[model samples]
Target chain A: MYIRAAAGISPQSSFEQILADPVPVTGSRLQCMEPDYAKLIDPKMIRRMSRIIKMGVAAAIQCLEEAGERMPDAIIAGTAYGCLGDTEVFLQKMVENDEQLLTPTAFIQSTHNTVAAQIALLLKCHSYNNTFVHRGFSFENAMTDALSLLKDGQMKTVLAGGIDEITDTSHTILKRFGLYKKEPFPAGNIFQTGSKGTIAGEGASFFVLQSEASGNDYAQLTGMDTFYKPASGEEIRQHISAFLERQNINREDIDLVISGENGDMKNDAVYDMVYQTVLSGIAHIPFKHLSGEYPTASAFALWLAANILKAGKLPGGIQTKKTPVTVLIYNHYQHIYHSLYLLAAC
Target chain B: MADLKKQIIAQLNLKDLKPEDIGDDQPLFVEGLGLDSIDALELIVLLQQEYKIKLANAEEGQSVFRSVRTMAQYITDHQGKSTA
Candidate 1:
């Protein structure tokens, strides 16, 4: 199926602001600050949701609104750490209170599937509702599930998305664990250094997908592949060749390649193989410096790809060098996961 | 005292609480406090936030957060409690 309507909420901006510029990071170290919850969620319910759920709900609603539909056939979401802020709060309570008295709000909100479940409850969507949490491949896994379901001819329109939010506590933990760079790096200039760690980030991106193309269709998903183990440069190059061959497309056919270059020297090296070997001639764009490295960060890249396909104009911030983008191959690799997606203008 | 009621309401984040309405001997959980599990967690924060008493077990919390009466008594019992 093709992506009909899309909406995203990141540290960058909401749907409206995103449509205006839609560029890669002009500076570096981008973090998705939250939008106003009162605008997207009900006042009564707003009191209950954590930042992640609120962002997911807002993006989901915005996608539906853009699609000119209320409920999709299925709603699937992916998150690496579900509501970690609430989880931290709950755990603190457990540890401090010594298991005597407890509150259920944080526990209820901390569930991995809370975003999907909340959306389902609000829309009363009794159809297929699933949430995947497999670290970096969470969003890719959800998209894979959606594609399989579409192939089965069971569902026509599916709403799929990925979202993750960072709290102060989680940020501290990640910093302590070396998931983030120790040095004080400006949000801008993140890509300048061939550093080891990328800046932490959070955001939500949602897409309204259907089996049939619509007037607002952005791109068609030809193929998607995910690798579990850490692939070396040669191995990654071979895998890309195989993947493109399976889709009957060559490296030259890929007009644009959005590489997940998060400024990490080791991780960014993975993309170098593709840039130097496979997609040497293709226009390569990176968004992690702009969006920051979140679990579902690829969703924003998917949004960028779709918009680029629709606009037929490469936004200034998104360009590595000036070139027209017709066919985009989005390559994303995180710890223990690598995903490649081929999207072409429909 | 009315001050105690106000303190409880403010500490627990009982947005619906009315200072004058909370009797001295009123319950704090399902009945008077009307707090659910999340609120109870908040109450644990409240204990730290206010009285600086830290109960490290759910069983201990059950006793501490039983009622306004019990809570005040616990606070009075464990004077000079420090925050976690």
Candidate 2:
């Protein structure tokens, strides 16, 4: 499939801005720099939407608008935690009211599929709608589904996206488990922190994809593959090699690699291992500094790679002037959900 | 009644509208307030949690939730009844 257009609400103001100058993530968490929803969604609808829903809907709408599409043939979203703010509200109310007198809005909108359903409702397009909630593999699985539909000729255009939001309750609980770094570090030095925990990141990225090229397409999504819980770093390297071989792409064909290194000592070790062996010496850049570390963060990487491929130049802060024709995105969340995406200039 | 309107606005997340914007007898459903079935349910919870009035019959929701006046009347008649 071809990524005709992409839009993301992330920690940076815009992808262009982030590429020009990497934003400094001073704290352990990187929150999405959201756009004003009043300009994108109706006031009536905005009143009821929680933050995550607003972010997801706004990104989807912006993506469709950029594609010049009124409606997509399908809407598919992947989220590890769905409507988390609403979920927190519902549970809090359930406890406070002792299982009685609970309001319905929070309960109604707390489902994992709410984002996809809300997008469909706003578009008034009664097409295929689905959401994947597989913890680390959520976004990759959603992309797989979109690719299947397009390749099968079942849909011409699909709005595929990955979204996750961080709430105070979730952040606190996750921090207790040591998921984020304890001390603050400059965002640009996330990989150099050499800390035990990575940063917490969240974002919503949507892509308008079609089977055929739109001539102004960002990049052609050649293929993507995922592996879960490989026993060793060698196994991970083999998986990357096998994926590239399956795509009929050689290592030399790839002009750049967007590595998912998030500053955690152990996590960076995994990428370091791969870099030493199979992915050695190729132009590689780390993206977790810009996006923070989340289950669906590879979505941000995909958006970055597509834009980089389309622009044929790396963002200013990275300092590479090479024009890349083929880009590889290799990311694994906590060394469990590993994925590779190959994209080429269309 | 004005307090009830404020409560309703707060509960329903009607941020754009103030209590005074909602007329006492204006329909709170389709035509006037553009609320749906979900908002109706929220209003029911509001009555129970805020006024301690448990709606006796679900069928009566149509009349009790018709307007701010009707809701206030329901609360006035049902408060102190220990429905909870």
Candidate 3:
């Protein structure tokens, strides 16, 4: 299936009117500033949603609006830590209140499948409803499911995407576990060496995938693959080679490579393998520095790749010495999880 | 007043302490009260249900939710100010 329309609401300027113009990271520590969700979400519904759910619904609504449709055949979402803030609130309340007089609001909304379920409820969609929570590969797994359903010819249109939000408690937990650095890095040179932790962020990205291409089709999903274990540089190169080979694509055919190069030293080695061995001499674009590192941050990168394919012009902030992108590959690694998505203009 | 504080704490889901621990002057967010964004929204709902205070703007809520002291003062001041 081809991606018809993609919309994202991220920590950075994703859905704002000024988002077309790039805004570089001004500081090392950055967090997602949520959009005014009441515009896309009903006020009554908006009163009950967590930040993650609100972002997910708003992104889905925007994608549907952009596709000029009111309903989809399926709704799927991938979330690593679903409604962490709400979960924390509920847990805290449960423990503090001794489970006596607990409100059902936070507890009900804290489920991993709450976002997709709420979206289905809002749209009144009784179609295929699924949510994936496979750590870092959540979004990729959801995409794979959406693709398989499309291939089976069961669904004509599907909405698939990922979302995750950061909370103070989660941030502290990750920092204590060495996922992020305690000290801050300068914002201007965040992409350079001496950087420790990727700036924590949160957002949601939704894509309308259809079996048939339309005049407004953004990009065709040519190939998608994911690896579970950490691979050696040689092994990683071979995986990319085999993936492209199956799609009849050679090394020279790829115009741009969007890498998940968060400034974390431990995980940056994965990108080194791809950059040095597989995608040598190709344009490499890194988005984590801009979007900040979240579980499904790769969804935003996919959205960026689709926009690049549709606009046919690489924006300034997204450039990594690449030009005239004919084929775009987004390679991402979150801890032990790795994914590769190949997108082409239809 | 004590019952109102207990209800606010319970509704906001601040599970760490009881109404006695949350002093009237204790802050609600970062240092004193330690509530976050989600808690802020829950507090908004609490205000609507308990005091019938309707705030259309989230920015206007910062001062209105400073602490139990501030919330009690606002409820007292705006008891019959508006229909909403």
DockQ of each: 0.20, 0.91, 0.04
Clashing pairs in 2: none
Please, what are the lDDT tens digits per residue for candidate 1 over residues A1-346?
7898878887666434554654354432356656677777776466677778888998898888888878789999999988887898789988987874556677888998999888887788898999999888999999999998888889899999998888888888877877777665554566667677777878889998888888678788778888777546777777778888998987767778877888878777777777878778777777776578887888888887887787776644555443344555555656467788888787
**Ten contiguous residues with the weakest lDDT in model 1 chain A:** A21-30
lDDT of 2 by residue, A1-346 (tens): 8999999999988877976676787888889898889999988888889999999999999999999999899999999998999999999999999998888899988999999999998999899999999999999999999999999999999999999999899999999999988986664577777779988899999999999998999999999999999998778888999998999988878889998999899988988998888988788998888899998999999998888887776864455446888899999998899999999998
Model 3 agreement with the true structure over A229-258: per-residue lDDT tens digits:
755667777777888888888878788887
Provide a comma-separated list of chain B TM-scores, one per candidate: 0.75, 0.95, 0.86
Better of 1 and 2 by DockQ: 2
**How many pairs of residues collide in each model?**
27, 0, 2
Which numbered prediction scores highest in lDDT against the true structure?
2
CAPRI-wise, candidate 1 is incorrect
Give the chain B TM-score achieved by candidate 1: 0.75
Worst 10 residues of 3 chain A by lDDT: A14-23
The order of the candidates by TM-score, greatest first, is 2, 1, 3
Off by over 4 Å in 1: A14-29, A185-187, A317-325, B1-84
lDDT of 3 at A167: 84
DockQ result, candidate 1:
0.20
Q: Kindly provide the TM-score of model 2 when superposed on the true structure, using C-alpha atoms.
A: 0.98
